[model samples]
Target: MHAMTLRLSPGDDLRAALDHAFRTHALSAAYVLQGIGSLSVARLRYAGRDDAAELRGDIEILTLAGTLSAQGPHLHMSIADADGRVVGGHVAPGCIVRTTAELVIAHLPGERYTREHDAATGFAELVIRAS
Candidate 1:
């Protein structure tokens, strides 16, 4: 496994930046080990919810982790607002960075990661395979 750290600038979309890194690195399989930063806007889908909840403010990213695949990223994060109220859920697009975001990602060599629909879960799920 190869590990790399990424720094995202202000105004960057958190998920989009990670996706870009996955493509830029030409990674077949990778996982976001951790992330820390702040977000001016966050879109998160709470459990059992269909849509995302938009949180806007000086939001601090307490935790972030997930897999990265060609299909997309399956990320989850916990964050705290300026008032210190914490919330966590599925990471969605449009999570704009407030200042900076530092992420460490692990790239697995010779492995392929994909997402396929699973009837059991009724959602697309991670599928790992040898490349």
Candidate 2:
């Protein structure tokens, strides 16, 4: 497995940047080791809810870790608002950066991964294709 470090600048979309990096590196399987940064606009899908919630304000990214595939990323994150209130859920696209975000992604070669819609769960769950 190979590793990569990414620093997102202001105005950069958090999820978009990661997606671009994975595509640029042609990574079939990867995991975001750590992500620390801040965001101005956050898009998170709160758990137990079908729709996503938008958190707009200065927020600090607390925890970020998940899987990345050609289909998309299954990332979860927790962010703190101005008052230090923490909100966390499934990460969605459109999380724009406010200042800078430092992230490390580990690429797993010699294997492949994919996501397919599962009838039972009604979601595109992780479907490992290789060991």
Per-residue error (Å), model 1, residue 77 = 0.2
Q: Please give, for residues 27-71, the per-residue lDDT of candidate 1 as tens digits.
A: 999999999999999999999999999999899999999999999
45, model 2: CA deviation in Å?
Answer: 0.5
TM-score on alpha carbons, each prediction: 0.99, 0.95
Every candidate's lDDT: 0.97, 0.91
Runs off by more than 4 Å, candidate 1: none
Tens-digit per-residue lDDT, 48-100, candidate 2: 99888999999999999999999978899999999999989999989999999
Winner by TM-score: 1
Please give the lDDT score for candidate 2: 0.91
Those runs of model 2 whose alpha carbons end farther than 4 Å from true positions after fitting are: none
Top-lDDT candidate index: 1
lDDT of 1 at 86: 95
Model 1 residue 9 lDDT? 97
